[model samples]
Target: LEWAGDEFPWVLEHHSNLEPETQTWHSKLVTENWDSPIIFTSMVQFLEVLFGGGSRGARRMHNIANSVLIFDEIQSLPVNCVHLFCNAIQFFVDHARSTTLLCTATQPLLDNLKFPDKGQLTLPDDRELVGNMTEVFEQFKRVEIKNLVRPKGWSEQKLIELMITQLKEKGNCLVIVNTKKWAKKLYDRCINSVDADSLFHLSTSLCPVHRKEVFNTVRQRLDDELPVLCISTQLIEAGVDVDFNSVIRFLAGLDSIAQAAGRCNRNGNLDMAQVYVVNPQDEAIDMLPDIKEGREKALRIFSEKDETELLDPEVMSLYFSYYFYERANLMSYPLTEKQAGRKDSLLSLLSDNHLNIGIEKNAIKLQQSFKTAGKAFKAIDSPTQAVIVPYGDKGKEIIAGLCADFEPAKAFKLLKEAQKYSVNVFPNVWRKLIDAEAVKPVQKGEGIYFLEERFYSENFGLSTEVVSKMDTKIS
Candidate 1:
């Protein structure tokens, strides 16, 4: 639901009641009405209404007051805003008659969440919706998790060899890596080794539309029981519905590992699929603290238990408990102390009515920092700038549209279309692209950049070496 606005049209196309005449009405309702009987929205959208400043925000708050709120993939909640999120959930349930459902394969310890004033959150007695969860897990156990990590880690060559071996044995498989760089490298190598049509690459480096196209092709192959191999980053760990006979995952969080395993034998058509967890020697872990920390915790659990226990719900609970304990301080908004001069988190700012009294005198500036607070709340810590890529014919058309004129409505429509051809690059990469003259601003004064070169490929998506080549040419 995070990209609800972008996904609205795609979703509506499949709706049972969808009609050509009523499509515009449905679109308007979805875009304007937050309190629609069924609405899809991002967490940021929800938070803005609850804690946002201005009359507009206050007006939207009523929509959520008596509505049912469901948060899926609960473990993905940002650590820095967990307390704020929990408090909001509690506020809706207690004060507004709203019911809240937090769903996850590996549930976090919500009881451990400590707010500034409310203390720990309390969940209902029958919080575990499924009875005999252990039995359910046993019945649904469709994969055998195999630890392939060595102290020295597997080199790219060795990893490729392992994948080839798996492909020969299993016929179709999915290899999930930790980073886009590694995913691209592996895909480049494997594309050469296998039939180009049977191999697929997926990562955030490719826009959603491109990924969707790749997924469709892969699905068709899988449906026909043809050989297929997909190399992807952690983006495919959750939400993706495709199944593979085998899965190879670069070591990360236990919950993430579980999610990866889900892609294997997802429909239980296979007796028991195989999921291999490996640590790649070529991929650097220093830049990814979450992956590093998660690997440590998951490794500790792996040391104490059998590999098969990786998907056990009890094991998952233990993993999450340890994971949360290690980063307990970060569970609250980090900028609270810096901005408020006290250990007052966003929850404290929203819940404490006394703070609102000083708005006239500026005695407390909590209300003033609402926008800043929202800006600071990041689910993923790394800041990335989106760049428009020339992915295909449609991608080229979008880029052409973006460059042709500056009409607000048409530009807005083109920008939405451009999402399919967009890729998010780190600041360093953005700088490199700028230096290479491979990117130009979307408009005369706009900050958004568009790829100026044919640096994207159908198979690999974006070429990471484009900047270096551009630098060489300039030199």
Candidate 2:
């Protein structure tokens, strides 16, 4: 739910009934509404409320009052504030306010922090949590990790050639890299090299609505066993669910490697689906702040201890333990600065489930909270224009006749193979389109795309420059 909140504006606006200003505010309301059995929110949203900055951040501070809050990608939290984040969770759990579960293949040594001189939540023994986590992973054999750490040899072309050969028979493949530019470059190369019916591209470059359309289409194609190929960044690595029969990852950190593996044969249907961990030559890590830090820590782990045992769960724990400790000092606990003075905020939030009951109670408290409506996002608005690219002479005529009232459903049907058009959206138009299934989400690697009716117009949002008219029309 919180994933959609963080990523999809439509989900956040409608489901949470939040205006633009209140989007981040709704993460707190997840537990207040308490409708679902599970909620997947980011580390920032979870920890921000505990630290308490403003009214919106404070809303969820009380929502997690009495429930299980699982922090996914716990290692991704900024380094200097690990003590502050962990201490907050400790307080909630220690006081019986909530059951806290930390989920990550790599566990940071959380005991390194010194909280207030008094009133800290005592944690469960680290040994037991680590043991249970390992056991759970072993039981779930959907993901199999293969470690291939070679210092040299292998160009991007060679990797793409190998993947095209493999994907021809496998039907679906995912290639994950470290950056958007590289993902785009690899996607273009794969599209040019591979003999596939459909090629998809995904990255964080596409807004959330655009990304969702691409993801949904790729997922449907995979389920139908259709020929599809994608290249993307690590955005799809963690919680995004479409599994490919094969996955190729450019190596960096052990945790990321594990996440890349999770996207392969995730249902455990194939007896032996392959996950290749290769080192990309000419790969730039300077743009990747977390990856750079994680790689440095992983190198230290490999050199001083456990060379053969690298990426092993135990080895990963130590790797993150060192990584977070160093990272925390770099940022100097920017989000956790309030930890010193606001001892009572945590205490008051944890004080009572008496506030948990009654819709009236929640309604009254929410009313008392500040209200902030959202600004209109230009990417999403009504009556937004789309482009019709005529790849050939015939395609040009088909697009030239387009009018505002022309049938969108039929116009989309004609542009299937021609130079494709870019569909633009008005505020909330995408939410309507998605609900009506007028537009479908297609996922390639980590980039999302959609196919919708082609409209002819010179004006558009940021998508205008991307639209090109093709010389030929299917008609």
Candidate 3:
């Protein structure tokens, strides 16, 4: 909205349809005409329509039949959905005649995916969209990665000092950490050391509105050539377009490192930018299995090759190939159950007519378990529930509107606006808040929750500190 201005006919279609314009555009996109030339939607929405059991989903399938489908950040696709997703893509290309593009800095080996009875999902003519991809990688190389990980990781104080030093040496700096807890802690320490305006923080905990405001301020400062420091989680690693003179990243996947590098000297304006990879002492590697595995594989690659090889296309291909090989079983939706010991996957349920047939006294009848399979397909492993936090005046207004008796449409509008003030919390933390009466259900059995003012902080949207302290007091 900031780049193209509000007048531009565009829509952001995610869970948060906060704007009426966006809501209108989304409604239009799912309709028969699908009049919107440009439409943005989540992967869940895309998959749901393909495998979802409903008349609405059927209608959406028809609407998307011949549309040009583009999947960005293709690496982020869940491993469990790889087979199901690949099968859907093949269906789109062969049956629907749709043009599909999977764009990512670190492209997975989709051709290696094996489908039941369908064989490997192969691209037509096995052609490359961009010939000589190595040349493209070399041309885009603007930053040099410096490995700072050691046996003993750097302390929080040491990390903060290093960041301050970088800010002084470099005009602007960005620090990407592994977790929100670390990001907030580093931000607090950095805020004390630097000017309030120069220091910034970004995390999933903050509402979309708050994050947008922070991004706008950071951009303005960067444009003006002022001192700016942003401490963020992996949220800023992809899709976000911002350039910093120097970047400090915690040890993660090589693809994640590449994405982080893309943020530094992004436009090739700088002569050479620096990207530092450090291992933080405070973070627990065991808590994050994916990062641990990626780090292990990345470290092995680094041992074999030079640091500059990090940006090489062949090296990236090797990293992805190794990464996928480690979790090969996950490529197939293994968690999905079978019917009467009959091997069945979401792909089979959606695509195979024989699997959908059941014999009743020698009579074949259609019996596809679309709803059951759809319910099991989760893009993210640990699903989060959204809770509206009392952040500012707009948040208060949304809460007041929700409490009052309004029409269903008006209530939905309020809910959308509330999305900007919402924080996604795990079920355990949500239960703790509920027990403490710090939050209330927006509606019974609706899954929507609301946080009271006391539990919220202006600095941090939803304050876990308040919840913890309250729990202590109660105990």
Query: Per-residue lDDT of 166-249 in model 2, one digit per residue for the tens?
Result: 688787788888876677677668655764346666664443444566788788888888877778888787678888998877
Give the alpha carbon lDDT tens digit for every residue of 1-475 in model 3.
3354343334434443222211233333323223345556667557656654444456556756787998888877776677777777887889998888988888877787433444345676755788888988888789988989888989988998999999999989999988888888998787679987788878877777877777887888898999998999998976888999999999988988988998999888888898999998868768676788788888878787798888788998888878877776666665433432356555555544345444543243544556666565555565566778776678888887776754565675566467578777776776788777888755444445678877865455576546332321100
- Please provide TM-scores, in order, for all candidate models, with all chains considered together: 0.79, 0.58, 0.82
What's the CA error at residue 238 for candidate 3, in Å? 1.7
Off by over 4 Å in 2: 1-41, 48-54, 112-121, 125-154, 169-171, 207-210, 299-311, 325-328, 331-465, 469-475
lDDT score for residue 110 of model 3 = 78
Task: Report every candidate's CA lDDT.
Answer: 0.71, 0.53, 0.72
Best first by TM-score, ranked:
3, 1, 2
- Measured with C-alpha atoms, the lDDT of residue 362 in candidate 3 is 27
lDDT of 2 at 371: 18
Which prediction has the highest TM-score against the true structure?
Answer: 3
Question: Which candidate, 1 or 3, has the higher TM-score?
Answer: 3
Off by over 4 Å in 1: 1-68, 96-99, 114-121, 336-376, 464-475
RMSD in Å for all candidates: 7.3, 12.6, 6.0
Cα lDDT of candidate 3 equals: 0.72
